[model samples]
Target: MSAELAVVYAALILQDDQIEITSDKLQTLVKAAGIEVEPVWFSLYAKALAGQDLKALLLNVGAPGAGGAAAATGASGAAASTEAAVEEAVEEKEESDDDMGFGLFD
Candidate 1:
């Protein structure tokens, strides 16, 4: 699949945040991205963390809000984490940089 055509979505499940994104709704994206969801596609088995604090959880999960300390810590770690994720994503893509959509000249 072309890197430009891949579609990725991140989901953050928060307590009291009741929102459902059914497969039917996501089907178009999934299809366009050339991805197939397995039969057991959704995760419903993550236990709440107790006493570890939000900062620790964020660092582990690598979520922006979670990594910014329990309240507000430095953004260095979060920035590094984000950089790493972006690098990884770029590496995962098989297309050469030139294959990306943007034209060099209009």
Candidate 2:
């Protein structure tokens, strides 16, 4: 497996086993997998997640219909904002198609 994938797998294992996902734990898992990864990468990952709730983050990510359900559960305002963004993106794509200067029926 690629280095990044190995690291992710290690994190997943930690999550599954209800162990805290720490840089030390990540390093231990990676080493057990017989891969050499830079210590800085583990440190960075741990730092990035340090103040956040991993279970909530993971739930938001792994839940089905994540964009809708997760948004609904977390922040209604964010859900509305996300809807607006999707509509805007669709509108932009439609406008670009029109800019091509031809219609399928023509």
RMSD of 1: 14.4
Deviation of model 1 at 103, angstroms: 15
Per-candidate local distance difference test: 0.43, 0.79
Candidate 2 TM-score over all chains jointly: 0.59
Q: After superposition, how far is residue 72 of candidate 1 from its true place, in Å?
A: 6.1
> Number of clashing residue pairs in every model?
0, 0
In the range 1-106, model 1's lDDT, one tens digit per residue, is 4322222141223211333444343344456556765423322211222222434445577444443373364568657766898998877563454478544362
* TM-score leader: 2
User: CA shift at 32, candidate 1, in angstroms?
Assistant: 46
